[model samples]
Target: MNKIKQGIEKLWAGPWVPPEHGKMPYFWLLSLAYMGWKYAYVAPGALELAMLVLTLALFVPLYLASFRARGWQVHACMLAGCLFGAAWVRWNPGAATFFIFACAMAAGITKMKHAMLAIAAVIALALLASLQASGNMRFLFLMPILTAGLPVGVGAVMDARLRRSRQELLRKQEEVEHMATIAERERISRDLHDLLGHSLSLIALKAELARKLVHRDADACAREVGDIEASARQALAEVRAAVTGYREKGLASALASARASLAAAEVALEENVERIPLAPAAENVLALALREAVTNVVRHAGARRCSVSLELEHGVAVLRIADDGQARSAADIRHGNGLCGMRERVQSVGGKLALRARAGLELELRVPAAVSSGMNP
Candidate 1:
C-alpha cells in the first residue's frame, strides 16, 4: 500500500515539474479531443495515425519538462511546440492546441518585453500554419487563431502579477525582520538604563558621603561602605536577571527604591499608591516606567519634591509621576531617549503615556485591566 501511494505521488508530481508551479498536465491533453473529427470522418491510413501518436508521445515529456526550464531552455520548448503544430496542422487542425500551450509557457519568461515578443511570434506561426493548411484567410480557418491570442494576453498578465506579488511578499518579510532586530536592541538598551541608572546614582552619593566621613567618623564611614556594597550586589543580580529574562521589578519594590533614590538626592518623596490587582506584565511595565521617571527627576528635574501615585480607575491602572522641579520644553522632552523609552514601554502592553509640563513635569501611564494574569494581586 505504501509503495502504491508513493508511485502515485511520484507520477502526479514527476521530477521535471517545478514544485512551485501548478499541476494537472494530463488534464490539458483532453483539448486534443477535437482531433476525433479527422479520425472519424476522413478515415486516415495507419501510417498517418502512427505518426500522430508518435508526435503526441514526444510532446508530452517536452510539455512536462517546460515547467522547470529557464532562459533559453524555455525558448527551445516554445520552438519545439510551434514546429510540431506547424508540421501537422495540414493533416490535423486540432494541432493548434500545442500552440496554446507554447504561448502560455512563453509567459513564464523573466522579461515581459521578451515574453510578449515570443508569444506574438508563436501566435503568428500558428496563424500562418492554419492559413497555409486551408490555402486562405477565411473565417472558418481563423477560428483556431483566436485560441492562440487569448492565452498570450491572459497568461502574460497573470504571470506578471504573480511575480510582482512574490517580490512584494519577500520585501515585507525582510522589513519585518529588520524591525524585530531594532526592537530587540532598543529593549536591551532601555532595560539596562532603567535597571542601573538610579542604583549608580545612589552609589555615587554614598561614596561621596563615605569620603567626607572617613576622616571625622570611622563607624559612619564603614556603614556607608556596607550600603554601597549591598547596592552593588543588588545591581549585579538585577543585571543577571535581565540577561536571563527574569527581570520583573514589581511596583512595590520600585516605590521603595524611588524613596531611597529621592532621599539621596535631597528630594522630598510623597506617595498615594494602592494595592490594585495587576497582571505580571502590566505591573512590570508600570514598575519600569516609575523607576525611569524617578531617575529622570533626580538627574534632570532638580526638583525639591517628587510625587508617585497609582490607583485603579474604572478597571484601568493609572500611574502618575510628577515633580515640582523646573519644567522642560516639549521639544526637549521629545528629544530625550529616557522619555522616549518610557513611552515605548507603556505603549507596548496596550497602555498609554502622556506628559504635561507647567511649573514642573508630570508623566502619566494608563494600562487596561483586561490583561490581568490574576496572580500579581
Candidate 2:
C-alpha cells in the first residue's frame, strides 16, 4: 500500500520538486475542463477519444519530465510540448494547455539569452498554431499567445531569483567554514608556543650552565644536566597533552597571544593585569573570554587601540576589554553566533558577560576567582 502511494506521489511531486509548492503541478490540470465541456455538448466519438488518450499519454510524460530536465534537454521538452499543442489544437481547443506547460518549463533555463530565445520560439509556435486553426487573427485567437507568453516571462524571473539566492547562501557558508579553519589553526599554533616556549628556554639555559661547569664543578654540572633532562621530559609531556586537545593555557599565555594577534591586525594593546592567583578552571574561562573579546576587536571592531585589564575585587576576577573603533548604537550590536558561544562558555563557568557601546565596543567578563592554597604566581 505504501509503495503504491509513493509511486502515485512520484508522478507529480518528484524528488527534485520542492515540497512548498504542494500539488500545484497536478492541480493545474483542471484547466483541461474545456475538453469535458465540449464532450458534454456533442459527445466524443471513438476516434476522438483515442486521440485524447494518446495526447494525454505523450503530454503527461513530457510535463513531468520537465521537472528533472536541464539545458538542451529542457529546450527539447518545450519544443515537443509546443509541437504537440500545434498538432492537436486543430481537433480540440483544449490542447492549448500544452503551450502553457511548455513555456512554463522554459524558466529552468539559466542563461537569459537562451531562455528568451526559447520563450520566443514557444510563442511563435503558439501564434502559428492559433492562426492556422482559427484561419484569422482575432482577439479570442490571441488568448493562447498571451497565456503562454506571460508564464514564460514570469517563471523565468522567479527561477533567476531563486538561483541567485541559493548561490549567495552557498558563498556565505564557504566563507564561514574558511574562517573557522583559520581560527582553529591559530589556536593550535598559540597553544604549541605557550606549552614549549618557557620549558625550551630553561633547558637551553641549564645546558649552557652544565657545559661551563663541567671542569670546574663536577657536582654542579651533574645537577644542571639532571634539571635539563627533567625540563625536557616535562616539555614533551605538555606537548603530548596539547596534541590530545588539552588547551589549558593560563591567563599569561592568553595575554601573550592577544598581543601577537592585535599587533598583526595593526591594533595596539594596553594591558594592566594584576598578579592575582586563580584556580585552573577560573583561569581557563578568563583566558577564553579574553581571547574571544580580542578576536572580535580585531575582526569586527576595526579598533586602532584596545585596552585590556584584569583586576581582583572582592574575590571575583574582573576582565575588561575596550576598544576605540567604529561606534554603533546598542540595537546595532547583534549577538551573533560567535558572541553567543562566548557568552555560553563564560556562563558555564559561573561567569557573567556585559557589553557597552561608547565610542567603540567594550566587553567585560566577571568570574569567581577560586584561589587555591598553593596557586601563587
Candidate 3:
C-alpha cells in the first residue's frame, strides 16, 4: 500500500495537472465507479469482461496525460480516448458514462465548432448501434443527449470563458509594456537635450575662438582646435552613456575646456573652483551649463576678462560664470537653444539658472547640495 501511494504521489509531483488542479482525480474515480456499477449487470463472458477492464485501464492514463502532451501528440491521444470511450459505451449500452467523459474531454481541449461537430458525428453512430441492440428509440435519442451533449455544452462554455480571460490579460500586459517603452524614450530625449545642447555650443565656441586666434596666438589656436577634435570624439561616448542613463562628465572637465576656450579668445580668466560633492547627474548638468555659459562668453561676449567661481552657500552649490563680454540682442539672449536647455536641465534637479546679460554675460546656476541623492544619477 505504501509503494502504491508512493507511485501515485510520483505521478502528481511533476508539472502535469488536469485542466484544473485537485479536481480531476475525482473525475477519474467517479468514472471508474460508474463503469463498475454498469459492468456488473452487463456480465459478458470472462474473456469479454477482461477486455473491458483492460481497455478502461489502458485508456485512463492516456486520457489524463493528454493535457500535458503537445501538438499532434495530444490530439492523437484524444482521438484514441474518444474511440475507446465509444467502444466501451457500445459494449454495455447502459454504460453511457464513457460517452459523457469522452465528449467533455474533447470539448475542453478542442475548438467549440470542431469539438461539437466531431462529437455529434461520433455519438450519432454510437446511438444508432445502441438503438439497434436495444431497439428502444427514446432511450437511444434522449439518453445520448443527456449523457454526451449536456457535458459537451458545459465544457465548451467554460473553455470559451477561460480563453477570453487569457486573451484579455495578455492584451493588458502588452499595453503596459508599450507604455513603459514610450516613457523611457521620452526620458532619454530630455537627457539628450540636456547633454548635447551645452557640449555642441562649447565646441562651436572653441572652433570660432581658434579661428580668431590664428592671427594673434598661432600655437594657442592649434591647441584649441585640438580640443575641439577631442571633444567631438568624446561626444560619441556621451550619446551611448545617455542611452544607458549613466552619463557623468562633471564640472572639472567643463571648466578645463572653458579655460582653453577663454585663452584662445585672449580673455584673461580668473577661477575659484573647489572639491565639491554632488550627484553625478547634478554635477554633469551644472558642468554642461558652465560649458554653455563660457562658450557664450567666447562667442557672443567681447569681454577682455572672464571670472569663474563655484562655492557652497546657504546649503546649495552656486556656480557663477561672468565675463565682461559683448551684450546680446534681446531675441537671441532670451530664446537661445543653449540657454533654454540650460534652464531646463538646472530646473530638473531643483536648481535655478539666472542670466545677467544687460551688463555682461553673467550666468549663475544654483542647486541644493544634497539634490543628487534623490535622483538615479
Q: Identify the leading candidate in terms of lDDT.
A: 1
**Can you write out model 2's per-residue Cα lDDT over 180-233, one digit (the tens) per residue?**
887666555554554465455456657777898999999999988887787688
Question: Per-residue lDDT of 249-318 in model 3, one digit per residue for the tens?
Answer: 5566677767766776678999988667777767877777877777677666678999998888877889
lDDT string for model 1 (122-210, tens) is 88887777766764323333466585456654665476569668989999999999998898788878878888987787788788888
Q: List the residue pairs that clash in candidate 1.
A: none
What TM-score do all the candidates reach, one by one? 0.63, 0.49, 0.46
Segments of candidate 1 deviating more than 4 angstroms: 1-84, 91-100, 103-171, 243-245, 328-334, 371-377
Candidate 1 vs candidate 3: the TM-score winner is 1
Q: Which clashing pairs does model 2 show?
A: none
Best by TM-score: 1
Error of 3 at 126 (Å): 39
Model 3 lDDT, residue 263, Cα: 74
Candidate 1 vs 2: which has more lDDT: 1
Ranking by TM-score: 1, 2, 3
